[model samples]
Target: MKKVTLKKNLSAAMISLLALSSFGGTVHGESKTGINADAAILVNAETGKIVDKYNEDQPLGVASMTKMMTEYLVLEAIDKGKIEWTDTYKISDKVYQLANAPGLSNVPLRAGDAYTIKELYEAMVIKSGNGAAIALSEAVAGSEGEFVKRMNAKAAQLGMEHYKFVNSSGLSNYDMLGMHPEGTGVNDENMVSAEDMATLAYRLIKDYPEVLKTSGTNYKYFRKGTDEEYLMKNTNALLKDRAYSYKGADGLKTGTTPFAGSTFTGTAERDGVRYITVILDAKDQYGQPSSAERFIQAAKMLDYGFTQYETVQYTLDDTETKDALPVQDGKEAEVKITVDKPIKVRMMKKEIKQAGVELKLDKDKTGEDGKLQAPVEKGEKIGELVLKNEKEAEYILDGLQRDQKVNVYASSTVEKANWFVRSARNIGEFLKDIFG
Candidate 1:
């Protein structure tokens, strides 16, 4: 297996195919965003831009939503050849008991019977099975205790600011029935802020998109054709045919615990844009815990994202780059530069028309006088040109203008000037200085 490195961000073009082909590119009117939740956030998955947010940074229990990180590590291990989907793990008595425990979300695991990693992964993702999660954790890291360490390490590596992973599953230690990972408090539950949840979701999709194949399924049978056959339905209610089904809704996780309430991380694609949303500890209008409440909150945010934003090609306008760079001792006195590639950004439809580009040249490539040295090659790297909207404030993470950026490159090669021509130019400059 090839090693996979975590990518900080993905280009919109990479997932553009998920967009609807029928979209006519018209921007929809903005809608009011009034979300009732302890914390909520809407993010443009491609650009990692925060579209709508409320109390996004407040850390709160994530309940089973914490399994997303577990899912990520399992996928990472597979990618790194540490494990295979075909690898089978024998069911231990502890895992079998946990799987059979009353009132917990789980699929039956027979003691002394071996189940493939793929089988357990499906159980964990589609059914939010606590037992399956612990089993997979042990398979990957030898024990839930060691796996919890890996979970926290991966969270820190991913830049999650407010988060703690006490166990492989998101269950509070009390829910673990004294089988919680060693060193964790009895009632400690997985905790994370809405913003960080979005980050984790984004990385999971970006890294192991194949996980969606299982998570998106409405239902599947575990241990099919056998006496132990059990049907596992995806917990993400927003999937097709579910009670709160929404178009383009697919793959993500839902969580609920006495402490966490109802929480969801949802994603949808439309018109060449995808948005990831998180609604944590949501309540219905009556301010009561309801499974449907998180879906409703997620729908509101998804609706706002789909209707209020537009993805369009961001190119250098015809009049933006007429200026040329002076080249010292080159065949030509100046070299023209242009954008190296096409850039796309998801922005509020109302603000698209107000966007402008700013050119930034690389200082290292040029001389003290801010001129390129001769022998410049066509398409040579120079610097990046940033797209900015004067009307918009930097609302996402700092330095992440979410502005479309493309490298600027030399449009044509400029050969070095001949010795005679160089001498004549130098002499002319010296004479002019003496005369002055």
Candidate 2:
């Protein structure tokens, strides 16, 4: 894998993108409401920005939604040539034993049974089959533990600071004989934050869209050998029930464990706009509907986001070069930089000009000239510009500070040479020209 880095500095274009007044006009200051879930969040799927949040940072158990990450790694393995959809895998004893074990969702695989990767994938995703999860993990990473390592590593790469995985099947914690079994601690399962769940959902839908092939299916049948066949049903009821009228509701994972309660990662697209919502630990005190309650809360949050916000682009012209700072001992003393593309902000028409932009530069490494130099690879940053409105300022800053900074970068190359070498080379050129 190749490493790519970005440097930004946005001091000059502080009020470039934020339309504070626009949002203030549209967003009527409504009273804050509480939901039944322990944690919940709604995010713009395209920008990965949090539109609404509650306890988003707190880590909580994510039930079968853990399968979403499992699905992601499986798809990644297929892309990397480690496995293929048509590849066949033999069911190991360990996997079969786990599948047959009491109190776990499974696809009912027998030891020594063989199934294709595509078949098992459907079982894992649509049926929430724990056996298939284990089988696929073993096929890809040679062991479930190793596959989990990859999962955690991928989470870290995506900035999921509060997530950990102990099993691929998400069946780590179970009560044996009404008492927590010895060595089967409560901490053995997967734990994640609402923000992290959203991040993972975004990656799954954005990067590995092919996984949805099976997840969206309402039912699938697996043929084991010529005489044996079993029908698997989707655990998610939204596909079956149309009354909810969830527009563009599509394939995603759901999870429920005794310890984890109920968890869901749902995605919906309307009029070309997509959104992902996550809810964890949603259970009713009485017999009231918990999943439905969480879904309603998510729908409300999403509606608020889509109705009130839009992504708008603001261009910082290359002609706006007055912000460039002076460089020492370089061919070009200064260079101009501007925003590469228009940015999208959620606001109304009245607040467009009030947005703030902040730019941040990468590490300022000195060059070979022995002067303070920038690694001025074209578009290297001079500083950052932040765009904020009155509300953002009030929250980000102590009071109503409107001005913010956006990043500036070098538009052209700046060449530097050692003093002794440059002096000698200039003399040699003069002598050659005059003597000739």
| Candidate number with greatest lDDT | 1
**Which tens-of-lDDT digit does each residue in 106-158 have in candidate 1?**
99888889999999999999999989999999999998999999999998888
- After superposition, the stretches of candidate 2 with alpha carbons farther than 4 Å from their true spots are 1-33, 175-187, 224-228, 240-245, 285-289, 313-341, 348-436
Cα deviation in Å at residue 232, candidate 2? 3.3
* lDDT on C-alpha atoms for all candidate structures: 0.81, 0.65
The clash count for each model shown is: 0, 42
- lDDT tens digits, residues 1-436, model 2? 1111110112112112211322111222321335567677777676565666676766667867888888989898899998989999998877887767677788888889888988788888988988798889888888776787888888877667667676777764442122222223443557777778988887788798876667767777777454557788776654545334355667687787655566777777777777778877674767343766555666666676677666555445322333454455455555556554444555544566675444444446343543336336677665544554624421111221234344556677667756875577678879999997
lDDT of 2: 0.65
Candidate 2 to truth, TM: 0.65
Q: After superposition, how far is residue 206 of candidate 1 from its true place, in Å?
A: 1.3
Poorest 10 consecutive residues by lDDT, candidate 1: 1-10
Task: Quote the positional error of residue 264 for candidate 2 in Å.
Answer: 0.6
